[model samples]
Target: MKTSLKSAKRLFVALIFVALGSCSIAHSGDGHSLKVTASAYNSVKSQAHGNPSIGAWGDHLKPGMKVIAVSRDLIKMGLKHNTRVKIDGLPGTYLVKDKMGKRWSRKIDIYMGTDVKAARRWGKRTVIIRW
Candidate 1:
């Protein structure tokens, strides 16, 4: 009976470790991971000045594109133009095709095209991004 109880305890500990490990993997991913503020934006005149569909790096943005605008500070951290990134809690990969203003730091703006409601729904939150 004592041997059975010990085995059960060991199994429980192993399961707990596995659960913890999986949680970290989901957030940290396989490559470099960073925690930053995430928001959503629309390609509109009110939101984007001058040419709304043109990115800071001269990339043309269109509707239904999976792209993000990274803060200026993130460029120094290897998140340069055209970099692919994986955002936690979001499916698929997002390309870094735009750039935020200098006032923002450690933040990313998800491009939502003309979906103003979706951008508003996204709001602002802290998220982990992998590159």
Candidate 2:
């Protein structure tokens, strides 16, 4: 009876591990995806208040860093600070380091690091994002 109870306990532990592993795997690559209006912004006095290089989450914005500012509505939708984002038509990933004003909704602003021209060139378009 003791051996059988031990074996059953071991089996239950193994099953719990399997269940947890599958849960992580399902969320790893298959995270939440959303379609949002994407635009670009530059780190300049006219664009950012106080310190232009400082993000809303207090992350420093340097040139060539892949970071984005999400709208307030998107924040409520799981795009919280420091969230990793996979943007369609863009390489690698971007981090959500800042946030837009309350007026903005369902939008994301790509950081261009003081390059106003580049920001303007990016313009605005609808793009899919995954996290």
Candidate 3:
């Protein structure tokens, strides 16, 4: 009876470990979730330069990609360059392509290709982001 009880305990412990390991594996490739404030920007020549300097990825911003500039602090929190993120209210996912300046914290800048008016309209708002 004592040997059987020990065996049952061991089996229970092993099952718990398997469950937790599976949960972590399921969430691994899918980036973690975070809530953040977001704004928009455009590359129009009139308002500001149309081109961004070399990003953390060591390349210029691609025109058509759904990309966002994340705050420096967020980068420290694992939202690093090339990380894919999903905006809660938005329809599609975005990539972390650039890093914001030190003055900004907990903010994300959505890149709207050459659409100055759209960027201005987007403005700023609190939104849920999954990275």
Please name the candidate that would achieve the greatest lDDT relative to the true structure: 1
By lDDT rank, best first, the candidates go 1, 2, 3
Model 1, residue pairs in steric clash: none
In candidate 3, what are the lDDT values of residues 83-122, reduced to their tens digit? Answer: 8888887888898887777899889999887777788899
Residue pairs with clashing backbones, model 2: none
The ten-residue window of minimal lDDT in model 2 covers 20-29
Model 2 residue 33 CA deviation in Å: 0.9
> What is the Cα-based TM-score of model 1?
0.77
> Could you tally the backbone clashes for each prediction?
0, 0, 1
Please state every model's RMSD to the true fold in angstroms.
10.5, 8.5, 8.1
**Residue 60, candidate 2: C-alpha displacement in angstroms:** 1.0
Tell me the TM-score of each prediction against the true structure: 0.77, 0.76, 0.68
* Local accuracy of candidate 1 as per-residue lDDT tens digits, 1-131: 99999999999999999987764323333667888999999999999888999999999999999999999988987889999999989999999999999999989999999999999999999999999
Model 2: lDDT equals 0.89
lDDT of 3 at 25: 17
